[model samples]
Target: MKAGYVALVGRPNVGKSTLLNHLIGQKISITSRRPQTTRHRIHGIKTTEAGQAVFVDTPGIHASQKRAMNRYLNRTAGTALLDVDVIVWIVDRPVWLAEDDLVLERIQTSAAPVILVINKVDRLEDKAALLPFLESAQQRHPFAALIPASALRGHNLDALEHKIMELLPEGEPIFDQDQLTDRSLRFLAAEIIREKLIRSLGQEVPHALSVEIEQYQTEGKLTRIAALIWVEREGQKAIVIGQQGEVLKKVGERARQDLERLTEGKVFLQLWVKVKENWSDDERALRSLGYAE
Candidate 1:
């Protein structure tokens, strides 16, 4: 049996979360069009006849290190590469960015074999452009395998999985066969609420916001959850609440639907917007909000 950990690392908005979900055949990680949507390192386990592959979905590595939150994200992404059996470096575009250079430098330190996955090939207008990009990538390092895949459209992913299984070391399954992820239901619920907030609000609000589940109780087939949405200031709170609390209402409704689907049971969700006074820049506030390094 081939069983080991696989780390997915890339810049923000490179479809790392989407790739992980498709690879595992379940939604273990939340995804969004916005960059840096994933702050925590999530584990998605895929067990097949060949072996069990535990995929680590990490926050995107970027150039920004100004805020305490940004530093925490970088640290989270960096730490996942330290002890993985294989690394799948995903990139959305054909051309490499300066942030990709930073990710490459980090990967150079890892002894595990790296597979360069070019994701979102379904959006590429010119098919011919990929060849040159692949050629240039090969000159940089001897990648274990270079595969062009679209995680959203389910293209070339089976081949990617085959390569991953081949690369993993021979061992017994680390997790139970039926398990899909390592995250708790409460943590996933909080992540779902945060995803709705990021999708509903403007670009600026997402960076200033964080979600925390203040209370969670499961009674029979129904779950009662109360969550707090932390914003940096009163004005941001007002924006999140919208006119007559429309924005918050919409976010709650979306989150509830997703929560029900994820939990496969009845859900009673309550969300409140509160001011936390620049939590992103404050180290203590960040730790209180679960951004500890």
Candidate 2:
């Protein structure tokens, strides 16, 4: 059987997390419309009769390196290129950015074959434009394959999966067939809370926010979790907490709903907003918050 690791590398907001979730038929990684939503290397394992594909969903590669968190995310995404059987380089429909070129340069150094995926084809009003774009992309590098797909609409994804499986090296399945992801429940719980915050809060709040699970316990059929939301300043904390704690309460409710759906059990979630004083720029603080590479 064919089995191997596939690294999904692309610039921010390219729908890498969305593709991974759809491919595995589950949500192994959290996603938001905001850039830099994914900060960790999440493994989503898909085992079919043909083979097992271990997909590594990484943080978006970007040009920003102002903070320790930015550097860590780049390092994590860059490191994922190594020791992989194939690389799926996703990009927005028919458009390439300077950041895409930067990501391409990094992927070129890797020995694995790369597949260029033109994601969000559903947004393409002119289907004829795809050919010229693909030709131009081909002129840039020798890609293993080029596919126009929509991760949101489930368009051509099976074809993409088939191509990935074909490129994967032959081997036995590394993970069990029933396994969907490598992340723990606690980690997913924290990510869910962060996602709620990102969706509910203002644009600037997402960059300043991080979630830490303080305590997790199971009582009979219920899972109780306490999470700490870290912000860079007192003002950010106040913004997150909102008037009469309404914002925090809404975030908690949304997170608990998602956590219940994910765990398939009742969840009792508690959230607290705390100031970390520019933790994103502080290496020690970032490490303490689990940003170490």
Candidate 3:
């Protein structure tokens, strides 16, 4: 009856969200090649024959010019580190260790039985070439269990699950079977919209963009949601909107399709782009956007 929490910590876009979704057997978190796709702490609960595993999916750790936001996110990430039964440090399979990778080395030594989950192994066609990367990762931290897996393709995930179960403390299920994720429907809706915008626009825009739900109501057979997508500059807004509203329309349609599936009803999604003029610097805006401590 082993049950406990496992914190998935890593640099941006190392497949932390994807690996969490895979472990939970559901899309509890969104995935994107773009870094910092996950802005908040999302809990994904997994119920198996043995026990339950609650995976805390957090924002990626990176160097931030915004020192306050960086400190906030870092503190949040560090908070998840405390009192967890295990820490799964996700790393990219193709790339070896770097100077920035030392952050994990310094922060993770205090964690109990830190496990290294080398993700995106599917990208490497040659398994032999991955050995060096794996070896280099092992040297960085004394991981309890080191496993190479592809979160997108579910490769070697069974091995990952078995190892995780073996490492967790024994107990009963913490969350109910009916509960899958900790996020509310509105929060997910906003994140879905943000995911679409990030994917469509690519790296032209910064990650300081955030979504806020303005109005949410249910009308018989449909959901009415009005949301605002806040960005830093007018140029970024134009990139998100595309030429002659085509890009914005595409983003909205894509978000709408997913929302319909999630809500199992008609979805009316209204997304408006607004420039908040140094929203990152404003502590109130940061807190409102769920980025604050």
**Candidate 1 TM-score, true structure as reference:** 0.99
Ten contiguous residues minimizing lDDT sum, candidate 2: 284-293
Q: For residue 293, what is the lDDT in candidate 2?
A: 57
Write the residue-wise lDDT of candidate 3 on 21-131 in tens digits. 878776778878887778788899988888888899888777664655666666677677778888888878757446236447545656567888878888878889877
Q: What is the lDDT of residue 110 in candidate 1?
A: 97
List the candidates' TM-scores in order.
Answer: 0.99, 0.99, 0.92
Report the C-alpha displacement of residue 86, candidate 3, in angstroms. Answer: 1.1
* Clash pairs, model 1 backbone: none
Name the candidate, 2 or 3, with the larger lDDT value: 2
**TM-score of candidate 2 relative to the true fold:** 0.99
Clashes (N, CA, C under 3 Å) per candidate: 0, 0, 0
Stretches of candidate 3 above 4 Å error?
Answer: 65-67, 106-109
Candidate 1 residue lDDT tens string, 91-201: 986979999999999999999999999999999999999999999999998899999999999999999999999999999999999999998999999999999999988
Candidate 3: count the clashes.
0
Model 2: residues with Cα > 4 Å off, grouped in runs: none
The whole-model lDDT of each prediction reads 0.94, 0.93, 0.81
